[model samples]
Target: MRIQVFAILKDFFKKEFELNAKLYTIADLRTHLSLLNPNATPVLNRCRFAVQDEFVTDEYTLTGNEHIVIIPPSSGG
Candidate 1:
């Protein structure tokens, strides 16, 4: 699956990237990501995920090859 990251996450993750794993849910994706990018785990936890252009909970299951949008909370002055 491809996780499209934006905002600060894009910078952390070096823009968009592909993930290949046996992940079954958003929670699993996050866990897998943490293991792959431990340095960004703190910020990763603050991110929200969306599938099929709609916001979804972490428990949402991924059947495979779903392109997920990773949107992190934006900061402002």
Candidate 2:
């Protein structure tokens, strides 16, 4: 699966990364990602995840062609 990142998530990764993983759910993706950057766990826990733009729960099933996006809450003055 190809997952994208924005805001805090983008900052955490700094650049796009690909992993040959067998994840099939949002929770699984989180587990896998946490291994790469343990410090991101907390932020990821509060982040909103999307499948091609539609927000979904952690149990949401992931597909091969789907692109996931993880974004943190945005604030403005």
lDDT of 1 at 71: 78
Kindly list the per-residue Cα lDDT of model 1 for residues 1-77, writing each as its tens digit.
Answer: 88888887765686777878999999999888889888879888998999989998999989888989987876868
Candidate 2, position 47, lDDT: 84
Q: Which ten residues in a row have the lowest lDDT in candidate 2?
A: 11-20
Query: In model 1, how large is the Cα lDDT of residue 17?
Result: 79
Top-scoring candidate (lDDT): 1
Q: 1-77 in candidate 2: lDDT tens per residue?
A: 66777776776785555556888888888888888889888888888888766899999987756777787877767
Candidate 1: residue pairs that collide: none
TM-score of 2: 0.83
Q: Clashes in model 2: which pairs? A: none
- The count of backbone overlaps in candidate 2 is 0
In the order shown, what is each candidate's alpha-carbon RMSD? 1.5, 1.6
Report the number of backbone clashes for model 1: 0
